[model samples]
Target: MSETENKITFEEFRKVELKVGRILSAENLPGYKKILRIIVDLGGEEREIMSGLAKHYQPEEIVNKNVIVCTNLEPRKFGDQVSDGMILAASNDNGRPILLTVVEDTNPGSQIT
Candidate 1:
């Protein structure tokens, strides 16, 4: 199908709450090889987001970085961990996750638009 055919209405698109978040910390989740438990600071609020970036990134590499986050996504459980949001990333040719981050520092919880 054409790209336009899969397009969503502006209202529908707005439903996704994309915001900037600063990674407070990142650590490998126990019993999971590819999952990392990341704590992000979205302005004053902190959220725990589970991401499958351990294979591509080290916990120390992502710590203190600013990244785009989908804050309103429904929480999902990974193993015994619950993810409160999603960290946006691009998949490379090798299907490795390349995290989406701001070129310059931005205030946490700033809207994407």
Candidate 2:
């Protein structure tokens, strides 16, 4: 496979509402092996997202970290919980999922385009 996969039209990409958000709170969702319920402050209000990053970092470590989230993604049911958005991340050296983080001190709900 090529380093880059097949290209997508700009229009197609635009459909994904990639928004910047701040982690306001994080808590382990009971009974899940790798899920954490995260509340993101998206400027106007907060959105809840369930991400599987508990094995890599403590909930406290991710609090206040700005993140890129796909807000338009269809919410999925995890056991009994619904994930409203996707917390973007890349694989770590050990192939563990590491959520993408922001560095420019951008405000929550900032458009990523």
Clashing pairs in model 2, backbone N/Cα/C closer than 3 A: none
The list of candidate 1 runs beyond 4 A from truth reads none
- Write down the lDDT that model 2 would get: 0.88
Candidate 2 local lDDT, 56-91, one digit each (tens): 778898999999998988899887889899999999
Compared with the true structure, what per-residue lDDT tens digits does model 1 show for residues 29-85? 999999999999999999999999999999999999999999999999987789999
Instruction: Assess the local accuracy of residue 45 in candidate 2 as a C-alpha lDDT between 0 and 100.
Output: 74
Which RMSD values do the candidates have, in order?
Answer: 1.2, 1.7
Q: Poorest 10 consecutive residues of model 2 by lDDT?
A: 1-10
Clash number for each model: 0, 0
